[model samples]
Target chain A: MAQLFYAADLFGVAVFAITGALMAGRKSMDLFGVLVIAIITALGGGTLRDVILGNHPVSWIRDDTYILVASIAAVGTVVWVRLTQPIHEKGLLIADAFGLAVFTVYGTEVALQHELQLSTAVIMGVITGVAGGVMRDIICNEIPLIFKKEIYATACIAGALVFIALRALATPPWLDTGVAMLTVLATRLAAIRWHFSLPRFHLLDRD
Target chain B: MAQLFYAADLFGVAVFAITGALMAGRKSMDLFGVLVIAIITALGGGTLRDVILGNHPVSWIRDDTYILVASIAAVGTVVWVRLTQPIHEKGLLIADAFGLAVFTVYGTEVALQHELQLSTAVIMGVITGVAGGVMRDIICNEIPLIFKKEIYATACIAGALVFIALRALATPPWLDTGVAMLTVLATRLAAIRWHFSLPRFHLLDRD
Candidate 1:
């Protein structure tokens, strides 16, 4: 079970790192910039989570494995982009959804382990799922997708709430995590497919 | 002494909040958006510092006073802008410099309290001084000022290093903080006055 969890975490990291590198490429950033963005996108969310929870040393700082994985994924992305053209938008979206789902579940589990309130735990999960992408967008000088009308953060929130409810009902841990991850992945992919989005908040209409 | 420190902190918070509200005003954000940005700009740096240092509940989360001060400042900015038709650029720059100087000293003090290495402490001080503005710029979809040719972060680093040196030389605590704050303020102001800037890093020159 532990190995499976680790595998999922690594998979999420790789996907996010690739997405980060692709963004840097699109912006025509240098090699160093690409690697920095990739590392931030792969680890920024969890680092924020651990920091907020008062977890010291942070995960990547404590164990070098996460950084190693992200760096390899970033290099792979650069090579692939050079060999074949840019990755299609659809493929990137799917990969991002997978990362969001896995990171949400992992973040929730960590918060719960620290005995945070369920509401706070759910918020933490959403933060973990969305913050890295937000940071990536911010660093690239773009508005964050989550703050837009996109249904991104909503999916994470839904998954986290469901996960907490299942745990409260005494469901098996693995089953709970599985259901939550599936819920996030399905919601995100469906949103993309249907072009579903939240209504924008406009205080005043501009010309 | 504690009261003096608290007063300086609140002054910094108020100045940063006003700057945030002004940025939001420039972006034509609504009242709610203005308030949100204001609070974020006032508290984001300190929160990031605390989180990175494994200090839980964060400063603003632990004490409601900071939020109260920021809210008041944001509203004041709105009213002031409406009445005065925008603050002068020079005035805003001075206020921002004041906030940066005070926050740098405060952040260094916090890092020293944690017994961090001198270099790490200096870095933390710079982060705390500039992160809020960076976040504000990012949220407004502008490139961060610190990352540009601006001498902002450098001033913070210089001040932090000086503060650490003074402490190492057994200078009085208050004197150390005072000198450091003045150093930052003077460096920043001089840079603005002289239009001094670091060279920009351009991986590829655009046509």
Candidate 2:
């Protein structure tokens, strides 16, 4: 189980790094900027979770492998985009969804192991799933995609809730993880397909 | 010394919160959004600094007073803005400079106490001073003002180095703190007054 999670975590990091690098590319940022954004996107979410939970020696700082992987992924992205057609926007979104799913489940498990309240765990899960992208968008000078009338964070929230509910029912670990990931992925893809979004916050518009 | 630092920290939080709320007002964000941005701006810097250094129970988490001060300041800004003329942009910038000075010194103090390397301490100080504003700008969907060839972070870096230098030279605590804070405030205000900026990074402009 640990080995599976480790592999999935690295995969999530690579996908997130790719998204960040692509964003930097869109902005025509230089190589150093691209690498900075990529590492921040891949590591920001998990780092925030660990810090909030008071977990010492944040994962990447304690183990350099995560940093190495993110850097390689970022550079590879620049090379690929230069050599071939840019990644399709649709494909990018799908890849981001997978990263989100993996991150949310992994974050939830970490929070649960820390014996935090279920609600906090769910919040942490959503943060882990979406914060990197939020930071990426912010650094890229755009409103975060999650804050825009999107179903992105909502999908993570749904998955987190489902994961907690399943754990309550004493479901097997593999089944619980699988179901939770699918819940997030399906919701995200469905939202993408249908172009549905939550009601926008139009508070105080009567200026 | 500890008491003085505590008072200054709370004051810094309140000032930063006001700046955040004012920014949200300009964007016409809702009240909840205003509060969220305000709290984040006030606390984000220290939170990031502590997390990066592996400090536990982050300052605001360990003490509710920080949150309370930030909330009150945010709400007060809204009321003040609604009842009176909007704060002058110059006034706002000056206020932000003070906040920046206070946060930079306080963060460096914390890092020094942790016995980290001097370079790390300087980096942490700069992060603490500017990160909140960076976040505020990002959430408002704007390129961060500091990243735009401004001397913002540069001032923080200068102040951090001064603080470290003074401490090494066996300066008195009061003198060290005052000089460091003044270095940042003076440099920032001078930049604002003289309208000078660092050279712009035009890396990779070739299409």
Candidate 3:
């Protein structure tokens, strides 16, 4: 892989690590739990991608650098949050949005590299992006964001489409990746910012 | 792959479908819930196996036979229980044992065919065997079987070792699969029946 690709992968890992740490902070979990979530969030999506694609040594086991970086980032986030600007619940959401975008793009690229079909790659990307968070939430005894919200997978889906479009339009792969990343980030953030909600199925009571 | 393979898969589906339908029955749910769980239990493990393996068209989606058999069995079991026997919780442990064993063997074979090393193949098998139940329990707001007492993954690990050992001993592949299956079933059933528990640990608490 190019140095640029490696940089992007590491960047995504750091972003997710911080994001998981931030979520752990919100729950007021101990430092260990904070670190655990951070490690899981950073490693989770890529691990899924590798396992699904039958990539051996699994990705983290192959490189191990990613886990190292995530650990440092997670520990740093916790210390930084404690020492510097106090973090609020809303702050965690912002970090989470960034984390979500990174994983979605990262996962899509991994799937494409493995030569999955366009649609399957897209679906797998979304699954990789969301499944980890779903797991994090389940472990924490919270409802998964994907199952509860309107726009969770929607953002990943849109970003994946953009990715494919860019590729088809003969754009440079890196540029396409950037566009996909930004599109997901913007869509997800905008949805939350505007309090946008999709139609909900309602129930009627019998008299 | 083989006639016996298909039969084992079908048996796994049928048993688990009945198990799922029976659980939903205890919930006094509508027929929809019963059918959904039945399908989930019957199809869930293989669906996950294919997804993780990146095998397209999933198992049931490819052949359609598994789904049909599972649905018929599910409906049949629910009706039979409603008309005849009481819904005994005793059957759940037995059904779970059967499903776990069958899916584990099936997953191991699929991963091995994909040329994964024995360790990765075994991990895939265990994950495939357990993940569906974890998913089902999560959706139903129950703690996952993976987190429950009674040596779940340990049982699978042991059976997978038996499979590997037998194969290494030049046991006919078919016979190896049978031994593995029976080992898983026996181990899991014995664990449940004897109320066996693995020692739990929390790293923080340990210190």
Candidate 4:
């Protein structure tokens, strides 16, 4: 089970790193800038979550493997994009969905282990699932997708709710995890396919 | 001494919050958007520092006062601007310098309390002083001022180094704190007055 979790985490890291590198490429950033953005997108969310939970040394700082994987993924992304023009939009979206699903479940599990309240744990899951992308977009001088009427954070919230509900029913842990991941993946992918989005709030206009 | 620290912290929060609200105003964001940006700008840096240092419950989360002050400041900014056209740039800069000075000293004190290495403590101080503004700029879809050949972060670093030196000399804690604050405030103000800036990195251009 631990090995499975580790593998999934690495996969998520690589996917997120690639996305970050692609963003940097679009911005015409240098190699160092690309690498920095990739690392931040791969680890920023988890680092924030751990720090908020008072888990010291942070995961990547404690274990070098995460950084190593992200670096390789970033370099590979730069090379691939340089050789092949642009990445397919659909493919990138699918990969991002996978990362979001895996990270949401992992973040929820970690928060639960720390005995946080259910509401807080769910929020933590959403934060972990979206913060990296948010940070990447912000650094690229763009408004964060999650904050810009996207259904992204909503998908994570739905997944976290499913996880909490399954745990309450005493479902097997593996089954609960699987269900949560599927929920997030499906919701996110469906949203992308259908061009679904949350309604924008306009307080000043209303007044 | 505790009262003085509390006053300084509150002043910093108000100054930062106003800056965030002003940025939001420039972007033509609504009231809610302005408030959200203001809160993030006021508390984001300290939150990041605390989380990185494995300090749980985060200071703002532990105490409701920070949130209260930030919200009030945000609302006040919106009202002030609505009633009076534009915020005075000079006034804003001075307030920001006050915030930077106070936060740099306060962050250093907190890191030192945790017995961090001198270099680490100094870095923490700089992070605390600048991260909020960095976040504000990012969320507003602008390049961070600190990263754009500005003398901003350098001022914080200078103050932190001064703080560390004073501590090594076994100076009175109050004196040390005062000197550090003065150093940051003076440097920042002087830089602004003289239009001083750091050299920009142009690696790609040079190549």
Candidate 5:
């Protein structure tokens, strides 16, 4: 029997893909480049998780639905971008936060299933969720925000811990996912609102 | 006894890490960010291989030298970047290509050791060699050249195929490694010099 979690995950994946496509449209990339970014934004996290756990067939490759959903969303986003003129830079950050939150919960849930410890699951959650964004930034020849002394990845980690806590309290799975996503979103929003940042810790002297 | 091939691999890894640090330095990333990029660039390919193969103690985690070498290189690169302002972008690309060639041959060798078929070995080689750059580019928030109708990955595939053919002809092990590395370097250099690009395949309809 298919569960509600699966449905939310599909929604998350679609939105992430759309966000990626919209972002790519800001550049002069061809359709394939847009598609590649879209796929990375949507499915890259789960791919990392599966690879880490040594799972077979890969998550998206196992069921074609993920790819199908992302492709459709990508095409839709491309159309939307062209019609809307240009994607707003500020709005893009908000959508990216949503993607990170949803993916963090899903990643943690998957890691727990793999018998990884709660701490490891939480780490994996943040890593899988934000790592795609990190990768996306790197490919674009920009230093990732995570390393830019931003409070970005910390929100994902905090949210993941919230998810684990709720699950431990016997919270319904839906509530857990929602709470986790909200935690991430709220933390991220607050960070942006207050310009939250992690203090730089430089081990070596830099002139 | 560790052979010349082994020594070359170490040298290539350190060089790759230095190149990665140089790329990160372009953005004035803090020391940690520079170090992280360099280390990831150096270890990313081999780590993917070990994870996919379910090899215990993922490559860098097994040998302290990989980490030490990459770290030293990263530190050196950062220092150089500080001493010399505004590195040439082309220099980084050439260094990256050199690293890619080395890793492609080594990746295929590892796959062969795992008794994988030629096609699988070639695919693995390409993945190991190019995924790091793809990951780096994504984190930098740029459209990866990998998906940009480029001949970068194609060169790796061609070089891998050459290695397989030579090995099948009973070439000596060290000779095979040397031949493969040289072939990869030459092919990549040619592609870069000639501005070689793959045929653009567009599956998306224009809006």
Candidate 6:
């Protein structure tokens, strides 16, 4: 189970790197800029979570494998995109949905391991799921999609809530993780398919 | 000396809070939004530095005073702006400059005390100085001013370098800090006054 989770985590990192590199390409950034953005998009969320939790040395700094994987994924993205056509947008979104589900479940587990309060743990899970994409959009000078886009963060929150409830029922670890990830993936995919979004709250004042 | 530094740090927090509130006002955000942005702006850089350095509890979390000062300052700006004239843009810039200088020097000191390498210390100092503003701008969905504006980060780098150089020269603590702060302030003000800017870097490719 541990080995499977580790592999999925690396896959999530690579998926996020591809998304980041694609965004950088749109901005006409050079290869160095693309790599930097890709790495940040892949590792920024986990790094932020570990930092906030006071986990020392950060994950990537402690284990070089994470950085290596993100880098190779970014470079591979550039090569494939240049040699062929841009990745199909729908395919990219499906990949991202899976990545988000994996990270959200993994982050909740990490927070629970550190013995954080339930509410804090759920928040941390959502942050870990969405923060890398948030940072990517911010660096690219766009409002974070989570704020106004489809049910992105909401899906993460749902998954986190499910995880905590399952933990309370003392379910097996693998079953609990699998169920939570599926919850997130289903929520996100359904939102994507139905084109549904939460209503945006905006202040009403004439400029 | 410690008391003085503490007071200065709070003052810096207040300055950053005001800048954040002003930016929020420009975006026509409500009071709650303004306060959220202000708190993030005032404490974001320090929080990031502490987290990255594995300093537990974070500065604001450890000391409620930081959050209190930031909140009060943000509210004060709203009241002042609504009751009277808006703050002069130049005045706001100058206050931000001082805040940046203080944070940079303080961040460098914190990193050094943590026994980090000198180069890493310098990088931390610069990050601490400018990261809050970068975050503020990003949240507001704008390109960070440090990326293309006057010698903002350059000034921070200059101060960090000066701090390190003086430390090696065995300068007194007070002298080292005072001189470094002055260096940043002078460089930043000169840039603002002279309209000097670093050359913008852009890749040339026909779309």
Highest lDDT, which number? Answer: 2
TM-score per model (chain B): 0.94, 0.96, 0.92, 0.93, 0.92, 0.94
Docking level of model 5: incorrect
Candidate 6 segments exceeding 4 Å error: A1-43, A52-54, A59-134, A143-207, B204-207
Best by TM-score: 3
DockQ, every prediction: 0.14, 0.12, 0.06, 0.14, 0.11, 0.14
**Comparing 3 and 4 by DockQ, which wins?**
4
**Which residues of candidate 3, in runs, are more than 4 Å off?**
A1-130, A145-207, B203-207
- Report model 1's chain A TM-score: 0.94
Clashes of 1: 0
Q: List TM-score per model, in order.
A: 0.62, 0.62, 0.63, 0.62, 0.58, 0.61
Q: lDDT per residue, candidate 4, B1-207, as tens digits?
A: 777877788888988998887776666664555666787788888988987787788766556678789889988887776666666656666777888999998899889989999989998998889999888888778778776444898999999999999988999878998999999999999988888887776666553
Worst 10 residues of 3 chain A by lDDT: A24-33
Error of 4 at A60 (Å): 6.9
Per-residue CA lDDT of candidate 2, range A100-188, in tens? 99999889988788777675677678778888988898778767766544477778878999999998898988888999999999988
Clashing pairs in 1: none
lDDT of 1 by residue, A1-207 (tens): 777778888888998998899888889999989999999999998988887777888888898999999999999999988998868877777888998999999899888887776766776787788889889988897766555434677788789998999988889878998999999999989988987765322222122
RMSD of each: 6.7, 6.8, 7.6, 6.5, 8.0, 6.9
Global Cα lDDT for candidate 6: 0.82
Model 2 clash pairs?
none
By summed lDDT, the worst window of 10 consecutive residues in model 5 chain B runs over B55-64
- Per-model C-alpha lDDT, please? 0.83, 0.84, 0.75, 0.82, 0.75, 0.82
1 against 6, candidate with superior lDDT: 1
The whole-model C-alpha lDDT of candidate 3 against the native structure comes to 0.75
Compared with the true structure, what per-residue lDDT tens digits does model 5 show for residues A86-160? 766767777878888888998898877766666557756876787777656656555555665546766887888
lDDT of 6 by residue, A9-45 (tens): 8988998888777776666565545666787788888
- Over B1-207, each residue of candidate 3 has an lDDT whose tens digit, in order, gives 488888888888888788778777776778888889888977887886676556777878778888898889888987798699886677887888899999888888777778766765676677668767766676677665655556677777777778877877988878999999999988888878897655432221110
Off by over 4 Å in 2: A1-47, A56-133, A139-141, A145-207, B148-150, B197-207
